[model samples]
Each structure stands twice: as C-alpha cells, then as structure tokens.
Target: MSDHVMACIDGSGHAMAVCDYAAWISQRLDAPLTFLHVLDNHPPPDEGNLSGNIGLGSREHLLEELAMLDERRAKLAQEQGRVMLEAARERAIGDGIAEPHVRQRNGELVETLSELESETRLLVLGKRGESAHLASEHLGSNLERVARALHRPILMVPETFSAPERVAIAFDGSKTMRKAIETLAASPLFERIACHVVMVGADVADLRSQSDWAVDTLNNAGFEAHGAVRNGDVETTLHDYCREHAIDLLVMGAYGHSRIRRLLVGSTTTAMLRSADIPLLLLR
Candidate 1:
C-alpha cells in the first residue's frame, strides 16, 4: 500500500467517477491503487425524548428501534463499500492494474483518511459526495475536515474530466510548496502536460535564483515548464491565472505556517475549496 495511490470511496456516483480518475492517474504514474471506505458514526438517541417513556415495554421498544437503525446504517455502509470497490476493480482491470486492494474502516471519515495519509502517495477524494447537489464544487461535509487534518497531497476530482493537458501550480516558496514542486518534478504525470508555476508573494526578488533553478530542473527533465511572480490574494490570483491560461488543473500546497493560526484565522486552501471551480490538487 505504501507505493499505491490511496482513494476514498462511498458508493456515490461522484466517488465512482473519482475512482476512474484515480485509476487513470495510477496507470499514468505506474503505481498500484488502493480504495478505502469509511462508515460514519451517527449521533446517539435524544435523552430529552426519553422522559416521555412510561413503561419498560416502551423502553425496550425504543432500544429495539435504535438497534435496528444502527444495523440498517451498517448494512448500507457495507453495500456502498462493495459497490465502489467493484467499480474500481473493474476499472483497474480494464486499465491493466493488477489485483487492486480494498479496505473498510468503521470510524469517523476524517480520522480514517488521516491514518491513511502516511502510506499514501496521493489521497484522491471526490469534490462533492452523494449528499451534495449536482455540479457543485463545494467539498463534501467531511472532505473539508479531512483536507485540514490529513498531512498529504489530495487530488480532488470533479464529476466529469478528461486527461489534463495543462496544469497551473500555485507556488509560494514555502516548505510544502517546495515539496509539491519536487514531487511534480520527479513524477511522470507532468511529462505530457504544460506546467505553469506561479509564485504568489513579494519575496520573488530574493527567490529569483531559486526560481531560475526550478525552471532549469523541469526543463532538464523534458518538461515544458515556466515560472512567474504574481502579487495579489492567493485564491483570486490563481483563479484568474487558470482562467486566462485555460489551465485544466490547479495544484498548490494545502496551507502554510502559522498553521496553528488556521484554527483562529482561516486558511487559503479552505477558501479555495469552497470557491474554486476547477479541479484542485492539494499538497500538505
């Protein structure tokens, strides 16, 4: 699983589409793929409503109802898991991926995703889950929380997509940004795409040397890459740049230091997830 692409599935049509993207990317990167399904625990029964119960018969009846609800939810989660895994398995077989693996976890969605991050090369999640409205870019109820908690790269897939011809990378010269840049440089997924690396900050004058070095690095690897310095709000700048260049994908580090400050102050990554219409590849 360490060398494989890790993806989350919930039996939703959007999740199945994400599986296709994951399979495509895995084949492109020559990596195996693993699918994970998580069962979300529901809230407990309302204690306030218990006061109306008169007899042990009523108490027993309520307990049985609650137990039935739990059993039904569990069955639904498992069914969803099987559907997603089967779809992924079929896609993998078609794409020549051998014996893909699937796992199930009974817990909170965010925690399960976080636990998988360490061994995951890329955590692929749907832009929106089953409960969401169609054509919405809003992250699923759990995706936003998972993105903030998981310290790994996440590729958020839209409902419909073709192979990306061009990509726009939002670089700010931070450590995680550098990590994402290095990962892309080494990965062959960028080989067939035109890459535009945009660094948003006023410190570009000082980073001029490093920027030049990065361009050379990509060029030497046969990548058609370019670097630019832009000054403005990060989300707005990247959005406009992608629109202007007709970029099919947007890649950027998930967040920056003052990381703890994100608890108090909001994060740019979260802002983009809510508002950015394009597919986003987020790195921690």
Candidate 2:
C-alpha cells in the first residue's frame, strides 16, 4: 500500500548499481524509493600481535579497540547508505519522481527485507558484493537463501548495469510463476515496461493453458505482454532469449529443491545467476 521500492544497500559498489536500478524503477512507477542497509556479521579487525595480550589492561585495551571498530563500522555503513540513497534520490528527481524516504536496519538482509514487504512494492538487491562479479562461478550463498525465504519480487541488479528497456519473465507453469505474474500484474512497475512472458520446457503440449492464462492476466492488468513457448533445456532457452533479444533484465521464479534434486536436475536460476550477462528479477 505504500507504493515504495525498497533497495538493499551495503558498503559495496554493487549496492550503488542496485540504487541505480531501483531509481529507474521508482521513476517509471512513480513510487518512492527506500534504501536499506542491513548490518550483518561484521568482520574482525587484524590482530597482528595475537601473542602479546594477557593482562587486565590488555583486555581493557582490546575491548576499547573493538568498541572503536564497531563505531567506525556503523559510521561507515551510515555514510555509504546515505550516499547511495542520495544518488538514487537525485536520479529520481531528474527523472521526475518524488523524493524517496531512506531507512536503515541492523539485522540480516533477508529478515529485514521480508519484514519491510508490508510497506514495500518491490525489493531491489545487488547480485553479489564488491569483490565478485555476477557471472563469477562462486555466488554468495545467502543470495539464494534470501530468494527462497521471501515471497516478494526481488530485482537483482548486476554490477555496471543500466535500466531495462525490455523485460522477460521466465514462466514454467509453476505456482510460484503464477504468483509472480499475478504480483507483477497488480503492481505499477510493469505499466510502462514492455514485458515478454517466456515459457520454456522440453514439452510444449501443456504450455498452452499456462501461456494463455498468463497473457490474459497481463492483458487484464493493462500490460501488453506476449507469450512464447520454447523447446529445449530451461537454462539454454532462457539464455538464448536474453541474447537474442538483448534483454536488459530477466524475471524468474526462484526454484528451491533438495540438494540431491538440484544436483541431479540442475537449477535454471543458479545456472543463469552464475553466467547471466544481464540483471535478473527473482521471485520466490
């Protein structure tokens, strides 16, 4: 009901990219943007002299050092969050969007994002931290976990990315896909964006109903969406679509299966996350 876009921010440069994407969305949708910085586990400072501390004064000094470190970390977080939020606010203003309200939280990113859904229209997040690339073989383990834990639509901003011109929604006829489609339809984000609903699987016999339903749903919601059914592996088909169309961003339902199941069948989302050239909007 708040009609605000919530963007997750940290001290990473990719978080700035998230703000850029969120600002684009907020402007297009005419929604306020909220920047959130979650204070997860902090890293410990270097203890170069680990063998020289064994006295009461040493203990006190250590405590003081830790307290100072904590204060510095908190200040750094606040400053980075403010700068990112200001960048987004300025971009939004230039694009004719109203000023956004920025807020911060001290908790796990997943928990804070889920808790803010009541007042958030969409959640935007970066693909990974500053040290890694979105196409890197190693992804942040928490990223997938957060995608699985939340039911809201999450826009994963890739580093050095731009706003989307055309969007593709990965549809596999799953309940989560239906929910994602429904959520996007009822929301204002897709009002001006050109959306293409893609259904990919080995078989196409049963895709008609789902594709028709999706098209009808989008049409009813005032979106001009077209349906396409592809025959091949899910990952291959999706990657091909993105490449062929030069898609700026992709929307897919995050698939969560057992470890064994995932290993055996493979995960489309994981594969794409590992090698995707564009940003992804994931919904669970």
Candidate 3:
C-alpha cells in the first residue's frame, strides 16, 4: 500500500496551516511527503456563446483572440502552481522532511485527487481555498467532493497551525467508527497525545461500553486515553467537549452513517467542518 502524505496547496489563507500540519504528520509517520497543486483552466460557459452575437469576420477574430488568451492564462496558472509547490517543498524541508516531492496537474480538483488516491496514504488539505472570501460561511467547495471521492484518511486544517497536544475522537459506536479507532491506534500521528473518546447520546450502558472499547484500544497502543458519554446533539456536543477540554485536534469517521440517516438528520461531519475552529483528522 502507498504510504506517502499528500498535501494540497492552493492560494488560500489555510495553505500555510496545511503545509505545517502535513509536515508534522509526515515526520510522525516517517513517510514520504508530496505537495500537489491542480490548475483548473476550464473556460467560462458564456465565453463560447459570445461569438454568436458578433459579425462573422469579427467573430472569428474574437474567437482566435479568446483562444490565445486562454492559452496564456493556462500557462500563467501552471507557473503560479509551480511557484507555490516550490515554496511548499521548502517549508516541508524546513520542518524536518529530508526530501519532498512537488506535483502540478491541470484538471478538476476532485478528479485529480481521485486519480492519485492509490498513491496517497494520507491527504492534507485547507479548510478553504482561493474562493474563501466568497464563501466565508462554508467550507472549501472542493472539500466534500474530494472527501467523498477518496477512501484515504484526510487532515483538514484551519487558517492557523498549532501542533496538537490533545486529540478528541468523536465516537458513534458504529463499525465505521470502530474501524477508525483501530486505524488511529495503528498510526503514529497521535502517538503520545492525550486522547478522549467522546460519544454524544444518552448515558446508556451500550454507549459506555463502546466508549470504553475505544479508550482501551488507544491505551493499548500507548496513548494517554480516556472516554466520555455526553447527552446532546452530536456536532454541538462534540464541539463543546473539545472546547471544554482544550482539545487541539478532532478525529472523526467521515460520513460513517448512512445517507438516508444523514438526510433525515443533518450530517454531523459537514456541521463540524463548517463550525469547528480546530483542525480535523477524518478517517474513512
């Protein structure tokens, strides 16, 4: 299986945070590091329709000019991506990575990532992209798409970076979440960090049992771990738990529940991504 850590770099406020977190994870896992940038050069739909409104001779000339302009833009975008990748590479090296790879591709973000998914053990991405200003209330437009398309673990960073000392796992007791706990136990990313396995539901026997199981798994793996059963909404309760515990990072099973359930009761994964200020490590 591939064991490289891939960090997606773009012109966003979260880019620096992404780089730092990726470097941190790479060092912890002792895995190869790669910085990826995708150039989205699809022309606007209206551009093609504009030619019909002009005279034949002028229209042909305008089309030619438009084509040339598109080509220029694509080249510029590639250059910009190259520069960004180079900077990320330097940052990774400064963070103790011996060697970092840089890759630039031209295509849609999700598609490109899906194509390279097999080579990625972990993916680090920003919470927002270049269009952050346009949608401050929402997560990065491509985040959900990419998360759904790839089956690997993903670390989504906010606009700032801080090495985590305390990490909380939002447990739900499903097989999906249980698998996530096992995966976390096998990884070094959260080694030696304080871990809290928090479940939001009635303080029932089953809930406590599941929580204990998760804590035991982590403890066996050498983590400073504990478990808690809270009563409230999943997202709100998890956020409150993190804040109250001064948690630095949140771990969760991304979209672990069924789509029908998510539709009936909004997705906790999406809600957390939209509201949580701390970085999230999503296991799939």
Candidate 4:
C-alpha cells in the first residue's frame, strides 16, 4: 500500500483545516504529503444556450464569441486551481511538512481521486466543498460519492482543525467496525491518543463482550482505550458522547449499513458528516 497522504484543496473555508490535518497525519505516519486541486470541467449553465433566433452571419459570430468565453473560463479555472494548490502546499510546509507535492487536474473530483487512489494511503478533504453554503447543513456533494467509491480510509475535516487528543470509535461489532479496529491497531496515526469505543444499543452481554474486545485490542496496541455502551439513537448518542467527552476526532466505518436500509430510514454516516463539529476518520 502507498504511504502518502492526499489532501483535497478548494476555495472553501475548510481548505486550511484540510491542509493542517493532512500535515498532522503525514507527520504521524512519516508519510509523504500531497495537495490536490481539481478543476471541475462541467460547463456553466449558459455555455451553449442561445436565446431567440438570429441571422446566420450573426449566429456564427455569437458562436465564436461563446467559444472564446468558454476557453477563457477554463483557463481562469485552471489558474485558480493552481493558486489553491500552491497555497495548500505552503500551509502544509508551515505545519511542519518539509516538502509537500501539489497536483491540479481537470475532471470531476471523485473520478480524479479514484484514478489516483492507488498512490494514496489516506484521503483528506473537507466535509463541505467550495460550492456548498458555509452555514448549510448539507455535506459536500462529492463527499459521500467519494467515500462510496474508494476503498481507502478517508479523513473528513471540518472548517476548523485542532490536533486530536481524544478519539472516539462508534463500534457495533460489524465486520466493517472490526476492520476499523484492526487498522487502528496496526497504524500509528493515533498512537498514544485517548481512545473510547462507544456502542449504542440494548446493553446486552454480547454487545459488552464486543466492546471489551475492541477496547482490549486497542489497549494492547498502546492506546489509552476505554469502552462504553450507551442507549439512544446512534447519531445523537455519538454526538452527545463526543461533546461530553470533548472528543477531538471521531472514527467509524463508512456506510456499513445497506443502501436499502439507509434509504428507508437514514444513514448514521451521513448524519454524522452533516452535523459533527469535529473531524471524522471513516474506514471502509
């Protein structure tokens, strides 16, 4: 597997937080860091729409001018992406990375990331993107798509970042959660951080056993691990736990539930991404 951390950059409020968090992860894992800015190639709404009829000569002239406009727009977007990538690189260096790589591509963000997934160890991006309203509860349009398409772990940062001191994992003893636990044990990303394994459901003996096993696995791996079972809705309970414990980061499996179930009810992953103030590390 590759060992580089890739931070997605854009002209959003969360860009700086993405850089800082990426740098923090790179330093922790002693991995290379990269800053990526992708210029979306989708044309503007008015690109080829011509209103009203006109003479052939006039129509041809208008078409030429519209082509020129499109070219200019593409060029401007490319330049803007370059500037964003450069700024992200500088921020990463300032955050203690000696050297960070930068790349700008012209394509959809999710497709671009999928093509470069092989070279990525961890993917970091904002929960929201440049086009998203800062005050809106909606997540970045591409956040869930990227998570669903990629197999690598993704660290979704908020609009602000702080070095994580307390980490919580919403464990449910599923295969996905078990994989998350194994990854945490094997990876040095959270070394020595206080870890809480939180499970929400009926307080049954089997659930307690699973939580204990998770806590023990993490504890043996040199983490300050603790286990707790809470009773309530999964998303609300997790949020409350994080707030009450002052958790700096939340870790969990991404979209572990089936699509049908999520559609019928809702997805905890989506809910957390939508509302969590702290950063999230989602494992697939």
Expressed as tens digits, the lDDT of each residue in 1-284 for candidate 2 is 65778887766667667767887888767777777766655433342223244455567667677677667767776677677667666765665656766776777667777787788777887778643444566676657767777666677776776767788998878776798899889987767677888987644567977898998899889988888888887888888988887778898867556786456333767777767768888777
Pitting candidate 2 against candidate 4, the one with the higher lDDT is: 4
User: Model 3: how far is 171 from its true place, Å?
Assistant: 0.6
Q: For candidate 4, lDDT tens digit of each residue in 1-284?
A: 47779999989888999999999999999999998998887744554324323345567668777667667877887898898888888888899999899998888889999999999999999989888767757887799899878889999998888999999998989887898898889889889899999999999999999999999999988889999999999989999999999999999878645777446223778888888889988888
Cα RMSD (angstroms) for every candidate in the order listed: 3.7, 3.9, 2.3, 2.5
Top candidate on lDDT is: 4
CA lDDT for candidate 4: 0.87
Weakest ten-residue segment in model 4 by summed lDDT: 46-55
Model 1: which ten-residue window has the lowest total lDDT?
A: 43-52
Residues 91-197, model 3: lDDT tens digits: 98998999999999888889999999999999999988885555655877689777767889988888899999999998888787899899889988888899999
The lDDT values for all models are 0.75, 0.73, 0.85, 0.87
lDDT, candidate 1, 1-284, per-residue tens: 56778888875666766777788788888887988877666433542223344465567777777667667766876787787678777876776778777888878788777777767888888888765666554557777877778777788877675678889887666666677777788888778789988777675566666666667677777889888777788778888888989988898776544857454224777878877766788887
Q: Give the lowest summed-lDDT range of ten residues in model 2.
A: 42-51
- Candidate 3: residue 166 Cα off by (Å): 0.4
TM-scores, one per candidate = 0.84, 0.79, 0.92, 0.92
Model 2 off-target regions past 4 Å?
44-70, 131-135, 219-222, 256-266
Ranking by lDDT: 4, 3, 1, 2
Off by over 4 Å in 3: 43-57, 261-266
Better of 1 and 2 by lDDT: 1
